[model samples]
Target: MVATAESVAAAPGWFTEAIAELPEHREVESAGGAIHLRCWGRTGTPGVVLVHGGSAHSGWWDHIAPLLATTHRVVALDLSGHGDSVVRSEYPIEGWADEVMAAAAAGGIAGRPYIVGHSMGGRVAAVVGARHRESVAGLIIIDSPFQEPSGESIVRQLRRTPKAHPTRNDICARFRTVPEQSVLLPYVARHVAEESVRDTGEGWVWKFDPDMLRKRLEQGRIPPLGSLRGVAAPVLYIRCERGLVTPERAREIAALFERPATVVELSAAGHHPMMDQPLPLVATLRTALAQWESR
Candidate 1:
């Protein structure tokens, strides 16, 4: 049930408004490849960059980004090997961090921007915060795990090269999160599913490279959380109630930071809050930024 333009136009008022606030599509060159991004709000406004999880793309934030754009310039990016971004021989988390900064500059964010990342993207954001503390305003990590599981192990466990589907409908029907969740909103899922695919001359297939992890694995090892110990930016760690990060784990991760970190939760939300609890997620993000601005 891929959502077409007609269906999105007919969606509820909130969704209709968000979807109507179209973003300016832009690309910035990175070490890996050209990073594709969608920017909303006027240039020179306070900026915030939203990053999707592994195997997910910026389209996942199509609905959420515009809502946040009311007070901030928002940019959601397709990391290399995902969505329309070029695939690279290696997929290092640090390289993804550089892409985030590059996208911010290319998207016309006037100053250092808050970097918000979900799942594996959160780890990438952590790297940005650690490496460029003076260059970033803050960091918001949503439900990212802090561990050193090998990329090969991750690829073996979660990734499978999907076969081409004969029709768009066929492909959308097969759309699922990597760590499949139980509480995805059907309308949101349908909309994202529609954007997740591309039509080749032969048929339709997912845009993300299935071998993205395998390529990273070839890099020998994924960077561990010890690198995050140097993070100096204020950190807001959002833990979804039904997501991967548990309360105990959240505290442990927070303690690793050089400064204090704030830990909060989204009630009843899954790992993919953009799919299951977008409004709450947006509200939480806005509230966090407001508090930081006042501080």
Candidate 2:
């Protein structure tokens, strides 16, 4: 759904209330660059780290993170090269994972925390679970493709510089997801779209580095099955019925994990569940966390 001024003004009470519980901003250094963090809830609570997809930043979880914060210390980070984080010469899955860990620790997560990631971030979360198994309690991957391209094909889509807009409103109006989905909440869309841009003295432009993907593609650093195989924590694989993971692929991904994994389909959601199905997504996550409490 396109975010119009009318829709934003009429935003549902829940969304307004959730976003009103503003997060505390923080910064932590990782892999030679500063990583930005947005933290919610009380300090010293169990942590939940949220990871956004490629081209997306921490604000993508603004609404969702606050809701998760009721019980857990929830933090969302701007991975290096995205959002407010400084750009890096390289963007590696391992590096992104490091940022996640650093942010979780600095954000006051009391113990081993749950890591939840969407799309490309899901792969990063898997890497964290695999490499730092003892530091993570569980993994939740939402709609990450079962496989990513390899070799030169990774850069088949040539990178382009984003055109700066004369005004922030213009930039926000032009905001669109990389792989556009059919369903989106206008209020949520407006919130993320506005958060996605920054005003350069030149003009308003997207905050994410345009060269980030080029660096990853050049290095052939796409997440590999080895990482998934290395994850030791129990997994919650959330597949949106209308999103990227197909039934067969979902099963394939679950099998890749040596640890126990459960697959739950979110009805009527797209790749971005937080955009189209925030409440249901929250309910699902709460239920899953409760079930894993005794584990």
Candidate 3:
């Protein structure tokens, strides 16, 4: 069962309309292989690079990017091993940190664009802020939790059956969030979900490589406390009220930063705010980026 054009009808008008503004694609070279990035807005304007969470691609930001593109040059990327980007033997957080720089440099995003990241991407942004402290304008981390890497999941080692669906309907039916949100806006969810798979003639499979999980698990590296304190740029930390981040944990994450981050909360959203709450998410980014730029 494949989702038809009729399904896109159910999505919000903003999303349907935003797709009309096409993006410029860039294939950035990294140590692993060519990294893919999508850009919108004029070439020389201040750049804002948006990074998606684990198991998701840049398409997750499609609707939101166009809105920000009006004010600043906006770009989103398929980090290595995810989306159409080249696969790696093993995934490293540092490699991803470098990939962000590579994409920005290749895209001609002028002068250390505002680095914004969500979930796992948030952790990667932290590494960028620390690793390239002076190079970045500022670091904005969205709803990324700090879990002890030592408590890594056992599921990564065990192999699970790869599920391929013959149609978009089959893929959409199987779609589920990592933190398992109880509710998903069908249109919003469908749009992101549609990009998550590729046609394999016989069926469609997820774009991300499973090996990325195995390799990341093998490395077992999450940004350490030192990286957090080393960040040179001003920080903006946004969390969702209903996301996996608990109030206590959010406070703890805030305490890790050397400079205080302007924290914002998205009410009634989950880990994947861009997918489910693009409007509020865009508004938060716009407001925070404005305040940062003014400084």
Candidate 4:
């Protein structure tokens, strides 16, 4: 459904108020592009880096970042080929991890930062927690899939294409979730749908490159995320009640954590908890971060 004037106006009061508190925008230079970071909160406090899922951008964190900013230097960056960032010749999990670190450093966020990522972003955070353990104090993976999909599903994902339209409204009209769910709150869905589009000169198009799904096609390999034993930091595995990750899978993934990995679920939330249940997600994150601050 398209986010019309009325729908945008219908955004939850708390959500509108949160986004009104603006953050500083900074440009981070990564390997092949200029990554965009929206930073909020005090400079000397502990740092938090937020990564969005495939085809998503920092805008996904708009209403949620401000809450965390109160106690930490929180920043969310638009990965390459998404949002305002330029597309690279190629994208890799390492490249995305590099962008997150680069953005954090450029924003003057000190300390081994806490990394929070959703979906594909979750995988990126996992990589950081494992490979760059010294750079992060902990990681929170939100509904990231741990199991590989069937070969047919992977092929279908790569071959899919976006439907182009003559106007922004036309595209937004058809906006829907990747793995469609019917229970998403209207205001939340409206906001996300509106943010996912861009006004190109010819017309409007999705903010992400459809080819991002072609990771297996281009690289001929999925990121080798073997055992979760390499991660040196605390882990909080949160799954949305209606998200893509199944409860059984959540247990399996959490089981791999060498250190105790706490798993929690948000009620009334789907794949995108930040959109459907922002407040609950914030509270959970706050509790975890508070411990880090006190330590």
Task: Evaluate residue 196 in candidate 4 and report its C-alpha lDDT on the 0 to 100 scale.
Answer: 81
Model 2, C-alpha of 205: deviation from truth (Å): 0.8
Runs in model 3 lying further than 4 Å from the true structure: 1-7, 148-152, 219-226
User: On residues 1-295, what C-alpha lDDT tens digit does candidate 1 reach at each position?
Assistant: 2355565456778986788788899988887368899999989988999988888999999999998898999999999999999988878777888899898888988788999999999988988898777889999999997776766677565555568889998889888886789777677888889888999979999998877766776445655544566787899999999998899999987887888679999999999999889999999999999998888
lDDT of 4: 0.82
lDDT of 2 at 91: 79
Model 3 per-residue lDDT tens digits across residues 136-233: 99888999986633443535433566767889667876877787776566776777777788988989899898666566654445334344788888
**Number of the predicted model whose lDDT against the real structure is largest:** 2
Model 3 lDDT on a 0 to 1 scale? 0.82
**Candidate 1 accuracy as lDDT:** 0.86
207-278 per-residue lDDT for model 4 (tens digits): 987776564344554656656688889999998989998888888888787886788998888887876688
lDDT for 147 in candidate 1 is 72
> lDDT for every model?
0.86, 0.87, 0.82, 0.82
lDDT of 2 by residue, 6-110 (tens): 889999999999999889999998877889999999999898999999899999999998888888999999999999999888777888888999999999999
How far off is residue 154 in model 4, in Å?
2.4
Error of 4 at 67 (Å): 1.2
Once fitted onto the true fold, the runs of candidate 4 whose alpha carbons sit more than 4 angstroms away are 1-4, 215-221
Number of backbone collisions per candidate: 0, 0, 4, 0
lDDT of 2: 0.87
Clashes of 2: 0
